[model samples]
Target: MRFERVWWGALSLLAASPAWAADGYSVLGDWPVKATSESGIEAGLKGNLSYDVARFGGADGGAFADDDAWRRQELSAFVRKPGMFELALGYDFRNEVWLDNFVRISGAAGDLRIGQFKTPVGYEESAVSTTATTFMERALPVTAFYAGRRLGADWTYEKIPNWYLNAAVQAGGDLLGDNRGRTLGARAVFNPVKDENQVLHLGLSASNEKRDDDSLRLQVRPEAFLAARRLVDTGALNRVEGIARYGVEAIWQRGPLLLQSEYLRIGVDRDGVADYSADGYYLAASWVLTGEKRGYKSAAFGNLKPRRDWGAVELAARYSHIDLDDAGVALGGRQRDWTFGANWYLGQHFRLQFNYVWAEARRRGTGLDPQIAQLRAQIYF
Candidate 1:
């Protein structure tokens, strides 16, 4: 409680800063701590803190402990010369993992980056920022079946108009030294109708990974972080040596309205056993109530900028489903969820989000359905 009190005090001061009212206040360009040198190098320090103020009913009945909404607390430091080169380091106080400590070099050949970065898959799973997602938590599908961050080398090319390509090779493990696997991944995107007010985009991604130990466990909450137990779970499946994942994504944005969808399928290859498969998908839509459009940059979606200094408001809905039962492997079972969300952006550095999830999961002839409500307070820079 004392730590939370101190954090809240700090947030109050940031909320009163005059800098957040500037027209240049941007999710990527503006920082709470920024400076520039005569040599034309820029440096910045940024961070975010998000937590659930309260949770009610639903899956979080204090059944499994940890019924708090302490989502994330992260800080990042970066130095760059315009866009030609940049170095960044990020750390998560809550998860105890290195986020994006990487070096990036840009040229006519596109961009090359090496370090701990995202693996270039799953759109909603990789929202530009933790605080920028349309909902307080990511959809169930993305959470259940995606390789999040990894230590790796990646290359990207966007010289061709309306086209983007990314290739990456990952080894070692995540910054936490878990899931030590060798993975090769690639993604391609085509944005045909790109303009100020209208856009259409399609993307495909695939990855193949081999682990030192052939085992995997898949589980996820019911679209609520404060939920005590994961509704669907595959305790542990061993014998598999490799995994292959394929995904397809699409997005259409028109003014203040945006529609997006994604599908992910995975194949688990086991030793002396039949391969098993799993799949999941989600559909999401959002409408900005204050005439602001969601930001899009570098093949990713970002937060919306308010046309007025008063800030922006958005309404969103998502339907997500995941099926982990394949062949005789029915450990995780199937889950379907419907989530309705509302977000209020209070200037550049703060926002408030609320979500209600209706979820149902069936496993081993047993079914669980819960209606949950949660609210989150966020501060980021």
Candidate 2:
């Protein structure tokens, strides 16, 4: 019911608005709501909302076990001055928590970022935004191994030609006061071939995390939005001391086609038991049917832009795999997912996405295969 209301509301908004091409890269343009002063201070509203619906078949138990919901993804506002600094504070409706509340200062050398933000990890985990991803959700390996937002400070240096480097130290937890531990992470990317019509990007990342106690769990959904259940979960392994994670990423883009792949490995150190390890990887490809080339910036791919009045069309496919069973632990399970997606970019602020997913999970010598179909309506300003 909630999903239906939000879905309708988004459609209504799209229908009521005039079909005007967005100005440059700003979706809202210079609206009356924004203010700019002589001192270079600028303030405006920023928010993104998405409603997702999904149907699942051949699943034993999970949120996607024939269920759907409307999710309030992100809501935020920001204040900034060009080339000086910016501050943004927002909330994530999906997790019902605070979003990226951070301040960044830029200079010739690099940028200094502070407050609660995402850790420098994998390409999909930290480099890309939810609104710009090619798929409805990120790959399972990224979600399982990469650290999300945390209270921390990060430094980014992109002065090197065709290269980007970032490092950060963060507190492991959300803003709601659930302090988990601490983490240190970094990422480096180099674009060997950067051109107007083609790009080849290679990147690597690593992170070390120390947990407060033995309780640590890693899990992920089967690449389906609104799937409340994680098909693979490494339920709270006790006496865990620390964790180390590593990742490698590569992306190649030519004309309207884009290819991306990443691999992640994690090692958990237990107090008295032998260290356990898990790994996952994914490969994805996307193409713009309307011939609009996908944008790339800061070692990540941006959103698609429509050239014609009818808007832009994109088709994407991805395959991901994760293994959580190791040594004496066989409870988390191993899973593989294949997803196909189609997207319609109705201007810059609105989009319609559809995805079909096939997932197979094996645990304790038993296997379960589930198929899911999902649709999403997204709006941002």
Candidate 3:
């Protein structure tokens, strides 16, 4: 009933919006809003809901039973001004929700962001969650060693008209379960040319974390609280892990051919004496069969698209790899994926996506290679 009410309210709002006019219904302002004009604080909401279907098979196409299907939902609200700041709030289906990338005020060319947000160390790492690569999963190395997201402050500079730069520092966790714990990290990006038709971007980032003993106590379920305490008392818990990440991506679009590539490296600080490092990258090209815009972000280019349009369509593919063992704890693994995807635009306030991934993972231990395939669909505004 609660969900129905929300839906009904949204429908009514859309019906009465200026977007509806007197003709009929339009996709614009269907539910949430988008940043259209840069007047007073421009505010809007966005959402993502995707269905993930996975199938696990061995190299020979035999099935594995551990695979299952799941659904994911995310909602976010953002407010941005042309001047000094932006605020965002988001909720993910994983029982986790917080201020997405709340940034503080900074000087002329630099701004600071704080809170739980994706790391700035990698190029794609900063892509809006809903507008990322594949839905069911990210790239291989991005999954294996990428630290996902952490609480931190980010700084960015765009003093030069056609050039931009960014840096960040983050805290990893709460002191224990109470939110006093933290992690430390930083990242920087340099863009030499920034234009609608051409651009060039390059970046580097890294971070380290020290876990809190108290926060460690709360990671377990209530049922295992006693066990957690026991492990802590015996010092059997692996308490420390630090992560370092670096990546660069370049994207270019000329006439109708769109090309992009990302190179990344990750190092992990684990317990005991076992350490690990891995590197992976992808080079992809796409053709806008219909002369549509293929907006992409990279070391060479960032978001590129013109306003006013019914919509646009793009088809793309990518290849990726990762190897996670240097000191031999045996976490070593690699994967390759052949992906086909499409993007649809419903004015500035809506986007729809579809992707199919044919992937295979190779593991070091059993000399077994597992093949997996998945499909994902998402809507964002």
Writing each residue's lDDT as its tens digit, candidate 2 over 1-381 gives: 644664576556555444332423333222345689998899987777877888777655343456666666787888999778999999988868887899999999799999998777667968887788899988999988877778888999998999999999888576887657898999999999999999999999999888776667888888886677777888878788888999999999999999999999998888887778999999999989899987888888888877864478899999999999985764689999999999988776788888999999887787768888888888766
- For each candidate, what TM-score against the reference? 0.90, 0.90, 0.71
* Candidate 1 lDDT by residue in tens digits, 304-335: 76665457889999999999887576467899
Q: Model 3, range 152-233, lDDT digits (tens) per residue?
A: 6766666655444555566654212233345555555555655566445555556554555421211110011011111001
Q: Pairs clashing in candidate 2?
A: none
- True-structure lDDT of candidate 1: 0.81
Clash count in backbone of candidate 1: 0
Q: What C-alpha lDDT, on a 0 to 100 scale, does residue 4 get in candidate 2?
A: 67
